[model samples]
Target: MTYFFPKVRQAQQHGWKGQGNKAGGWQEMSRVGAGARLFEATAVGIALLCLGARLEASELRKSPVVRAVERASPAVVNVSTEQEMQRRPGMFPGFRGDSLFEEFFRDFLSPFPRGQARTSLGSGVIVDPKGMVLTNEHVVQGASSIKVTLSDQREYQARLVGADPPSDLAVLLIETKEKLPVIPMGRSNDLMIGETVIAIGNPFGLSHTVTTGVISALNRSIRTESRVYKDFIQTDAAINPGNSGGPLLNIDGELIGINTAIYQKAQGVGFAIPIDRAKRIMRELIEHGEVHPAWIGVEVQSMDEALARSFGLQGRKGVLVTQVAQGGPAQRAGLRKGDLILSVGSSKITSRQEFLEALSAYTGGSQISLGVVRDGREMEVKLKAESLSTQEAVRMAERQLGFTVDAVNQASKKERRAYSMSGVVVRSVEPQSLSYRVGIREGDLIRQINDKEIRSLEDYQTAMARALRRESVTLLVQRGSYGYYLTLELGGGG
Candidate 1:
């Protein structure tokens, strides 16, 4: 990568004396050649330019990452992993299922080879003095031979302590007689946009390379090969292919982020896992070897000003429960379809992410109180949260049109101020549920059944009993404030 400079041209006719110079009496000219003068000037200019570039390059080489790597390289270790993978010549194309090339290539080219040792390399941080290390999960995804290289050039076999792929964070442990230098963890929340950050990692097998840049953005969502990391701290830090699992530190020498991914097509944009989220996952992994999150089994949506006004909500706050899964904890506790969830226990949940964060903070089987608004009535419901089987959860998520009703009562109207209605409102029909398949919901409001006009719970029961008697029945339904008609529907299928 050499850069060429433009060739300087010499001025002609240097033999003739200039009028400005002292008059020469046609004597042997003392005047220097223009070409020589141009050559000398060009040499001096080139030397000055070289000196300036050297100074600039020197300054860039001494930047923050360069400085941090010098100080923290001792704690950063290289990891080599070996894993075992399935090998079958028939499983691949251009294979006879019996060739040595196929068999050997399958084993040789894999990150995890069959029966033989497969090697991978990445960097790690020895965060604990007791020899606990932090690295990316991808580094040890299926490793069989894990090695750690210290700054002193000593290599030691390491073992996986725990790993969480959702956060792309992993922990390793090794035995040593002496304590290793640890990087101090810092609060990533204190980071501001444009604040300088340093990335220290082993890039392209080049150990202890440092790159520096200011925080490009905060709370970024990044998609990587490992996981979809949300709330990442984006920076201009020069992270390359082999920089995974390295630390992104603040100026005060504290680990703020974990260098994880970079935008391949773009320049100066990189992302790191925020230290706070990583620490939470690490604690769970190191302590329990698995993370157990509380499951409420309800679909919630954020309440915006428009939705709040439409729902006639008091203060445009709290997460709105859009749909409660059948047989879930909320459903078992009598939580209905159109309830506005005010809070879970003492903490107020404002968004879906906040709800998930709050829920993940709690252990499974914890009983919590839920504040909700039903038909404009504020009530407290005690929900004993339980983790449901995957199959059961999937089943519950599908029964959306099993029931239909309208917001008719005063309390229901006040709670659903957005609808601007006084009664239970029938919004939409779920396709696969019993009601929609039998022609229900969308505009049908229960006016009455079997000669009785349905107005409340008692009236609804009476109408339902009569309608159930007929395989297909008709019910008096109100389409608007004044219009009413008979809506026939089939029963006994759910």
Candidate 2:
């Protein structure tokens, strides 16, 4: 306590100097008594602090939380992104549909105006000494240019490695050539509730702002428009809009999570991606440019105690298989309707989220053992999960067709769109291409081609190959769940 109150003690000693030289001996002694009383009060306060009441000022400055910020600040960065969005043709000065309109407005509808330049700010963490940085996908999505400013004020132009919108994570690379400071990574799996945590980010353009709180919850579920990743670390770390993708550190100054989202309506409620999950994603993005999702082709329902009884089961111990995809890994491995999946590998399945999580651990071509219950019997089955990279499906659509397409199960570049069935989505149609003229515009799903219903990537490709053989083809398309017919006639060599 005296260490924290040295200035007060020094002032008291100085204040009594002149009074002692004067005739006011009694006044000087009274001042000494006052100083002694103050010292006693300070001692009591320090005693209370030691008893876990509060922290002394000097001790607070040297706390673990402050030390964590000092250790991690060098790895934090401020991200600024500038994107040039293409401007479309706006309405002309004159109106009409024919000769007069075209004649009067010859200079109108000329070349589109220059693309609008938009700038945004966010936070990022330097994860590697090789100049690899991690941030939120939304922070740099569609950015024509990105600039990263380090804690030391060194700036560099960043290149996008890859971005996954579903995960809301993006990686950027800068050619710094020299070694960069990095934060020590910590394990979120070992994190306990109410453990001390620190968040450092650029909130509202405020760079390297530090906030501290306790881990409020773990494995929190976040629901967006189209997807949900059930593992998040909830903290009250004052994460703001621009704080997205910053580091969430443990008391040891090691990163345990990434600040991602905050509820607008609720105060002190913020969410972060656990560092354990992010490590895998970062490795995948660096190696493959994207994280591939592992999927088992089946429709599953969570079994409740009542539902288990109705299906003649004992307790709520497994997920029920309502339907299995034909020619899929589940069906090929003898999985059938009405079979109950009791466990995957060594982990028991109790919810849809848990089952999906277990299945996600295995990649394509990997063999997995499933413990299933058939009619009046329990059984073990082994199968190979059979999805090539879902990104490959998207790349196929873009390469073979005159447009980019999206699938229901794909991790989009910028969003998680709602797609109920397995059909290829027309994301962007090439200008003046047959797809554009045929009313096959963006947002249309090629549901069927000449009665060959498109249900998968294989079906879409086969139908497209058949359509290429004809000069014209009729396609049944679904636009926003509304079905319609479109006839596309191609010119020779188109």
- Among the numbered candidates, top TM-score falls to 2
Candidate 2 lDDT, 1-494, residue by residue in tens: 33344544565667755554555645656676787788889899888777763445566668788888889989999999998867553355345456665544444563433454778898999999999999888899889999999999999999999876656788999867977898888887788999889999998899899999999998776776445555688998899988988999999999899888544454778889888777766776787676554445665767888888989987648888876766677888899988889888655778655676556544445568999998869999998765443443334334334577656465541243535456776678888776676667776777887667887667776565434323345778777658888776522110
Model 1 per-residue lDDT tens digits across residues 1-494: 22322222121145334444436422223233454566678888999999999999998788655565666667778777877655533455665665786657766765545565666678888888988888888888888778888878888888888876556788988767677888877887578999888888888889877788899887665655422455678888888766888888888668887787444554667788878767766766678674444456676666788887888886747777777766778788988765787777654767655454345434346677888887677899998776444333323322422555554656655543323342235545677766666565565565555455656644554345323322334555555455454445332111
Off by over 4 Å in 1: 1-71, 90-117, 224-227, 262-266, 294-299, 302-310, 313-319, 322-494
Model 2 per-residue lDDT at 367: 65
Off by over 4 Å in 2: 1-60, 95-115, 296-299, 304-307, 314-318, 322-354, 357-494
Kindly provide the TM-score of model 1 when superposed on the true structure, using C-alpha atoms.
0.53
Where's the lowest-lDDT run of ten residues in candidate 2?
392-401
Model 1 lDDT, full chain set: 0.66
